[model samples]
Target: MIFIIDSLNLREHEPLVKDMFRLRKRVFADRLGWDVRVSQGMERDRFDDLDPAHVISVDDEGRVVGCMRLLQTTGPHMLSDVFGAILDGEPPLRSATCWEATRFCVDTEVLTGGRASNSISYVTSEVMIGAFEFAMSAGVTDAVAVIDPVMDRVLKRSGNAPHGYLGTPKPMGKVTALAALMDCSEERVARIRAFSGIDHDVMQPHRVTA
Candidate 1:
């Protein structure tokens, strides 16, 4: 499973990005009835656009299975405007060098049994871990992850402790709610890569240090 990591804003990647939104709607808005984002039909905003964001995940055969996004606050991000309510007193932007992790969704099409752990949930976990590594290699010092209970656990276990975590983890699918931050670390990056489930034999050595 050779996952692709692209800038996401590129024209060639449009379809992949679109599928990502569709999946988000299915999981968050349509199925769970988060309706809050139903009007958009697709859950996307400024942070998903003009912001410095990256889309890293896998497209098995043709369908999108695993997906996650990275946002650098050095520019602009959803934390500043979109879902400000979740932050309470916490600053939306952590630092000039800090970034935010957002819009993470994994497709349900993957087969049984996850990559690393015995639990199937590790499939999604592997993707997020990969995203963390990608963020670090991209030059992120600190990262704020908008998360809930499930994800907060993963983020805290991201190897290196990030710099932001405030309030409780409520439920908000793609509306950009709840946040946790961590400083980027090489160790974390490698751990995430190994967790990517790329079958160590094929994972490009340069792309993953672990």
Candidate 2:
């Protein structure tokens, strides 16, 4: 299942949050070899301090299997702060209805046994469903992500292709990154669900209590 976690209520879900960070470290640093900040085995950075919302996918045992970060476009975000080069000469997209999605990672070891193709596709679509659900609830119209060409193909092949793109692709780290935007609508979510055979709500009930 998936959990929609925001910074305001993160304290109650400390364990899950920690697992998300560790999972990120494994994917971004250990596996992808991206230049990211890692401390004490957790991959996090200043953007994490911005209190963005997160869509986290966990197994039945509550182990984090996938996760992504969402931040308002009007605020400090990866596209503006870290990936400005991907935007080319265009101004960074800024709109209340558009939110930036970043730090997308999945724990393949836990979710997929030996990089099984089916498992990879399912986990990818599952987390995307979580993203659209959260964006709709928050009144966001667009979900933008800075992703590599490989991820772009994965999204397209999974039936959740970006509705638009911000700028041309540029080399980032070991891969080429570009800004892709997906519409935040029920119709789009339904398409992905139909493709992945996930016909239920992806969001897990919030057990966090203030």
Candidate 3:
């Protein structure tokens, strides 16, 4: 299942959040070799302190397997603060209707099966659906994500391709990073749900407060 956790109720879900950070450390810092900060085996950055909503995918055993972070573009975000190079001199997109999605990572070690609910592909799709739906509920029309080439390709293959791009791809750590613009619409969500055969709702009952 998917859980939307933010600063409002982070203290109540401390263990789940810690596991998510550890999973990020294993994926970004350890596996992908991204130049991310890892202290005490947990990957984190300044944006994490900005009260961004975290979309987390948990297994039947209640272990966090996949996750992503969402921040309002009207405020400080990675594309505006950390990854300005990808903009190519163009100003970063800042608006209340456009949010930034980042820190997307899945625990591949535990989800090593096929495209079932317990597999990586299923969890990835679930997380994407959860993020988009959560954003849509908050009156957001668009979402900008700083993704790598591999993730871009994955998005395309999964029927969640970006509608546009901000700028050209730039070399970042072991991969190339680019800003992708995606619309939070029902059609897009339906396509993803059909592709993953996930017809049911992916989100939990809790709502995230801005």
Candidate 1 Cα outliers beyond 4 Å, as residue runs: 1-9, 35-41, 109-113, 116-122, 154-164, 170-177, 193-210
What is the C-alpha lDDT profile of model 2 across 1-210, one tens digit per residue? 888788877887899999999999998888777889999999999998988888888877767888999899998888887788888866798899999999887777766632232377777888898888778777888889988787899899878999889878987667777889899898999889888888876777763221
After superposition on all C-alphas, the RMSD of every candidate to the true structure, in Å, is: 4.6, 2.6, 1.4
Tens-digit lDDT track of model 1 for 1-210: 324444532465677667677777666665444533543456765455563454445444566655666666756676776667676756666565676776665555453544543233554555655655555666666677765454555555544344556565555644334677666676665655555543343222335331
The alpha-carbon lDDT assigned to residue 115 of candidate 2 equals 25
Instruction: Using lDDT as the measure, name the better of candidate 1 and candidate 3.
Output: 3
Cα lDDT, model 3, residue 199: 95
Best of the two (1, 2) by lDDT: 2
TM-score of each: 0.71, 0.92, 0.95
- Residue 181 accuracy (lDDT) in model 2: 89
Model 3 residue runs over 4 Å out of place are 207-210
Give the alpha-carbon lDDT of every model: 0.56, 0.83, 0.89
Q: What's the best-to-worst order under TM-score? A: 3, 2, 1
| True-structure lDDT of candidate 3 | 0.89
Q: Per-residue lDDT of 31-124 in model 3, one digit per residue for the tens?
A: 8788899999999999999888999998999999999999999899999888899999788998999999998878989987577888777898
By summed lDDT, the worst window of 10 consecutive residues in model 1 runs over 201-210
The per-residue C-alpha lDDT of model 2 at residue 177 equals 78
